[model samples]
Target: MPPASHDGDRDDDDGGSFIDMESFYASSGVSFVMVLLTIASVLYINPYWRRVWFYYVRITITSCYYFVVDHLPVPVKYKVLELRV
Candidate 1:
């Protein structure tokens, strides 16, 4: 076999040099949901708005024993995307 390139040699066993995850991965199923929630939270909160509290209202909302079923619209999602680097 031919020699691997520098980048090729440094890749993970799966062959990704820097795995650009479409989403987070966790071992436990519940833990997996936590990862998804974290990513979702990052994508939901607006930056210019500046969070009102130390913790996001959504995270606290659950602690409040309230469950909101409806999803926010596209424009609201953009609010979070704007927070990106």
Candidate 2:
């Protein structure tokens, strides 16, 4: 995309400075997945997806699954993963 203006250099925002938007939900989804994966791999006695001393597809799949489901609006079931209000 072209710059917003042509003053001296190019301005990112037509108004003047940059406009930063908060992405809470998307960031929450990522954090949720990461947290669950770490907890599952490191804490659980017999984790649903851990049986090794190294990372593998098991970790990948579980993390991805948690990440995807973490974004769904499934009430407390998934909302509990939220790190923010």
Candidate 3:
């Protein structure tokens, strides 16, 4: 590709950088297929890994919730508890 003109105006000679979606998708189809296959394998091929992943996600969320609650000011914590009661 020729160097861009010093001025901001585009030269008529250049076809411009328009993307052809059909060609782009054709080229990228293999990557898309690979990704889908990977996702399907992880979700269906190995049930044990799926269970472990969910378990870790649940534990991570629960721990973060506890950490936030535990770090609250004592007075605020007491107020929250009183409100709950």
Candidate 4:
């Protein structure tokens, strides 16, 4: 592609010099896939890091569960506690 001419002869109706939407989305999708693959490969190669990652995930989920349970209304809490038994 020739360098975009700075000469003021370009038509204003052409919508100017912008990236193609389809190409932009395709590139973005490929980039995200590459990033996920890299992360998966790293985790697969390092068992200790994978375990640590899962540990953090478990802790985060447990914390969120307790937080939600603790904030429940008294009647709801009673029902939940009864269900636990």
Candidate No. with top TM-score: 4
Q: Mind giving the per-residue lDDT tens digits that candidate 2 earns over 1-85?
A: 9779747776555454353334556788899999999877574666544555336767888999999988867867645574786
Q: Please give, for residues 4-31, the per-residue lDDT of candidate 1 as tens digits.
A: 7666565447545375443234346668
**Relative to the unseen true structure, what is the C-alpha lDDT of residue 52 in candidate 3, on a scale of 0 to 100?**
89
Q: Write the per-residue lDDT of candidate 3 for residues 1-85, one digit (tens) a residue.
A: 9988676575553445477666788879988999989977887878998898789989999999999989866665457444553
What TM-score would every model get versus the actual structure? 0.23, 0.26, 0.43, 0.60
**Model 4 agreement with the true structure over 17-76: per-residue lDDT tens digits:** 487667789999999999999989999999999999999999999999999989866775
lDDT of each: 0.58, 0.68, 0.80, 0.85
**Candidate 3 total steric clashes:** 0
Off by over 4 Å in 4: 1-17, 72-85
Scored against the true structure, residue 31 in model 1 reaches a CA lDDT of 85
| Model 2: lDDT of residue 13 | 50
In model 3, the worst 10-residue window by lDDT is: 76-85
Residue 57, model 4: Cα distance from true site in angstroms: 0.9
Question: Native-vs-model 3 lDDT?
Answer: 0.80
Checking candidate 1 for backbone clashes, the offending pairs are none
Summing lDDT over every window of 10 consecutive residues in candidate 4, give the lowest-scoring window. 76-85
